[model samples]
Target: MYLRLENISKRFNSFVANHNISFSVDAGKIHGILGENGAGKTTLMNIISGLYQPDTGKIYLEDKPVKITSPKGAIKLGIGMVYQHFMLVPQLTVTENIIMGTENSWCLNLRQKQEEIAALSQAYGLKIDPAAQVENLPVGTQQRVEILKVLYRQAQLLILDEPTAVLTPTEVESLINILRQLAGAGKTIIFISHKLEEVINLCDTVTVLRRSKVVATTIAKEVTPQQLAELMVGREVVLQVNKSASVPGKVIVSVQNLSVANDRGIPAVSNVSFQLRAGEILGIAGVDGNGQRELADAIAGVRSIINGKIEFNRSCTRQKIGYIPEDRQKIGLVLQFSIAQNLILKAFKNLPFCHHFLLQPPAINNHAQVAMAEFDIRATGEDIKVSQLSGGNQQKVVLARELAGEPNLIIAMQPTRGLDVGATAAVHSRLLVERDRGAAILYISTELEEVMAMSDRIAVIYRGEFVAILDAEIATIEEIGLLMGRGTGGRKSAGTG
Candidate 1:
């Protein structure tokens, strides 16, 4: 075994993060770890990467027992981890970020170091300009820089947590190829992701953890995505949504020649046009940071539209729309507020939640009680701050607040971004319920599978434009992916054409 754990356990006060977890990885092989959020997958990875010390465990490397005290200590043990969110400085060059601490800054030769790093990248099939700024690179290229950063430190063991979460389909393929090359050259990899298909397709062996315990470890080739889902959630999961054919009603909102600028005042959404009806879901699918934010923000009435026409249904006003922003913590809810306050955010000035600028605690608490029970938000009480809740409960709070009234239009952006399987299913079920209730929903997500599974009509966005708008029932992943990569519609069919 290249790496092994003997009855590893960790605890933070009364909560058990990892419980006697034991697993091994073969040398130069990719080992996948699967789990729901808060299932101790991250805890285990943190222990291995020396961010935390296991309360009770023995980690064996090359058949010898070792203790990792800190991240630098872990690095000295030839272990490195690339987090889902990159830690590179945006203003630094790729070479600078890679060799930030590896060499003495005062005595460093910039050109010589860049050439060495360039050679290392080429050897591992990770091609990038050493002198290019980190922020100027694409998401996939940034990920390659992260990997090269690890390997540059002579790390033989690699831990990647949710590596493909934000990557495009093309970028995902490129990463898989790069990992294979690294493994062939004798690097042990531990792959962690919520994506079951990716784990099955790339990992040699897979381990599933549930409720802070190892449920199973099996050969990747022997298990299906459904089986893996079951192992991860401890129940049969509905990986696909089952819905009747959408009865799309009259157009709830129509957009023409829309153009919007990002936070930097540069055009992010360009000349995009579409009509969303009262029942069907129009899913905007693309890679992360690909104009999804600006487009959604414009429709939600949160950001200014540089040049466009957004007409609501004669009976539907902008105030009647429910907007679920992508970042729930930042835009959706106030962390310091109680559940009661958060639930009534949109209608705080209304009769039930408030009256004459004098807060109505009784009505607010009563409303929260109803919303919590209805939305299945598992919190100690309505008085507890929103920050104390889990990611799922936090999302439920957002959903409860947004879906308070029977809004005619809903703008949902990456609603299930950080949620686990059960929570994901809940979000989907609630959105589908609203869709059935004749609500026009614009669902934007970086997750391609999620967009396809949830939408009635699929709009493939590329370079701030809708390259292809196809009927979800007839669209293939290949067709959508091609449109995304090509970044142009060409002769492809467009919105309801």
Candidate 2:
């Protein structure tokens, strides 16, 4: 075995994040750690990468017991971790970002280091322009820069957490190929993700974790995605959405020649027109950063529309809207606030949660407890800060708060981005329930598979315009991909055509 973890356990105050989990990975093999949010996958990886020491565990490298005390120590011991969130400096060049810490103060060889890094990138098929500013490169290229950074540090064992969460399908495939090449060249990789298809496709061996315990460790080829989902969630999960044909009702929202600007005052959403009907899910499918955010925000009344009109149904008011922003940490919830407080953010001044000149604590606490139970929020207490929860749990809190009021129109932006299969299924079910209850759902996401599965009608958005609006049952993946890339209808039966 190249790496071994024995009887690992980690605790945070009253909660056990990891408990007696043991797994071994052979050298030069890609090993996958599969689990739902808060299932100890990240915690275990943190322990392995020396970000946190296990309270009770023994780590062995090359069959010899070793102690990883810190991140620098882990790097020295040939371990590196690429987190889900990129840690690149946006203003710095790729070369500068990569070589930030590893330079000699007396004799700096910047040119030589750039050449060496460039060669390493080329050798690994991780193409990145060393001189390009990090922010100028697309997300996929930035990801490659991250990989190169770790490899440049001379790490033999690479740990990646949800590496494809922000990548397009093509980028994901390219990353898989790069990982394969790395493993082929005698590098050990520990892959962590909620995405089972990628794990089943790219990894050699897999470990399923649930509630901080190792439920099973097996070869990837031996288990189906369904089996893996069941193992990770500890229950039978419906991988596909089981919904009847949507009986769309009266138009709930109408956007006429709407144009919106991004944060930089650039026209991100231009001349986009669409109608969202009650009892329907209109999915806006596009590559990331292609005006989806601006359009969604405009509809949700957050972004200012520079041109045109968005008309809500006569009965629908601003308070009747439930907006789930893509960047939940910044827009959706108050991270520093308690979960209960965040839950009541929309209705703190209204009845059931508040009265006249004061707030109502009992009603708020009871509502929060119910929301937590309904949403399956895995936390020790409801009053804890929302930031303390895992990504998926935080998303659940957003969903719980958003959907609890039974809003008429739901603007769900990337609702299931970091969620596991079971959590995704639950979210889908909740959306369907809302749709059935005559709610108009504007489902905006870059996740093609999800948009295809959940949307009643799919609209392909590219460069701020709706290229095609196709029936979900008839749209092909190729058609959507082509439209997303700014290609014309091109002899393919796409959209309403």
| Top model number, TM-score | 1
lDDT agreement with native, every candidate: 0.91, 0.88
Cα error of candidate 2 at position 83, Å: 1.8
- Per-residue alpha-carbon lDDT of model 1 for 300-350, expressed as tens digits? 888999998988998788778888999999999999999999998888888
Q: Candidate 2 — worst ten consecutive residues by lDDT sum?
A: 488-497
List pairs with backbone clashes in candidate 1. Answer: none
Question: Could you tell me the lDDT of residue 286 within candidate 1?
Answer: 88
Cα distance off (Å), candidate 1, residue 236:
2.4
Q: What lDDT tens digits, residue by residue, belong to model 2 across residues 254-279?
A: 88888999999989988888888899
Model 1 Cα shift for residue 223 (angstroms): 2.0
